[model samples]
Target: MYELKTKETDDSVIEFIERVENLKKREDAYRLLDIFTETTGHEAKMWGPSIIGFGSYHYVYKTGHEGEAPLVGFSPRKAKISLYFATGDPEREQLLESFGKHTSGKACVYINKVLDIDVEVLKDLIRQSVTFLQELYPKEQR
Candidate 1:
């Protein structure tokens, strides 16, 4: 498995969010931080240089590729807020259909504003994604 340094939760993530160009977007980023931490019971951590991630999981594909990724995360990108999580199983696609006013890019869901989506629905999406991943690769493997 490819090894990555275990990420530590830090206040720098909040500082980074504060630096977002749009005030409303910055607030939305912080709100996502709160929801992710509260629901996942994992503090926010800066991933690489930009992504604000919560919890983590280690993954090794059958092809022998491996890496560690956040259990759930988001970034306030210049174009839109990019939400991150596993997109596995059929039910996840069902949730995405009802997720509202958002675009999916690869594995990340791009939303312009948190106000554009249902907060509770977003929470359920995150919860289900995390649970689905856990079933495939438990926390102990992370």
Candidate 2:
């Protein structure tokens, strides 16, 4: 039984943002908070100690491993902000072409700040992530 380390908690999202040491990152965190919330239509929740997540869904793999995860989220890290989105969406790569300056991994996109990326593309990414997850885990209610 593997445990999910990033389970959602009752931690204060605002306090977490306030603790970000960098002034610009702190401000970007606030802006991202608004973007994710408005785009997903879900209030932010603290996932683990750092991730500010907007919505959630449960997933079970073919091997029987299962856990809950946010539909979209972001963290203002020491080096850069990490944006979480659903993986395996081909459209994500297409959108990133015009997303301004950002780097991405399988499930996370890294950006210096909100100003460095196109906010409209960010919103589309958020929406696409939520839609992709919901479709994949259709029975799990958010």
Best by TM-score: 2
Q: Which candidate number would show the highest lDDT if scored against the true structure?
A: 2
The TM-score measured for candidate 1 stands at 0.88
TM-score of each: 0.88, 0.96
The local distance difference test score of model 1 is 0.84
Residues 1-142 of candidate 1: C-alpha lDDT, one tens digit per residue: 5456645445598789889989899889888988899989988898877889887788778997777778889999988999987876677678888888999866888999998988888988889888988888886765
**For candidate 2, lDDT tens digit of each residue in 1-142?**
5678999999999999999999999999999998899899999999999899988898888887888889999999999999999999898999899999999988789999788999999999999889998999986343
Model 2 regions more than 4 Å off: 140-142
Q: Which ten residues in a row have the lowest lDDT in candidate 1?
A: 1-10
* C-alpha positional error of residue 26 in candidate 1 after TM-score superposition, expressed in Å: 0.5
Estimate every model's Cα lDDT from 0 to 1: 0.84, 0.92
Root-mean-square deviation of every model: 2.6, 1.4
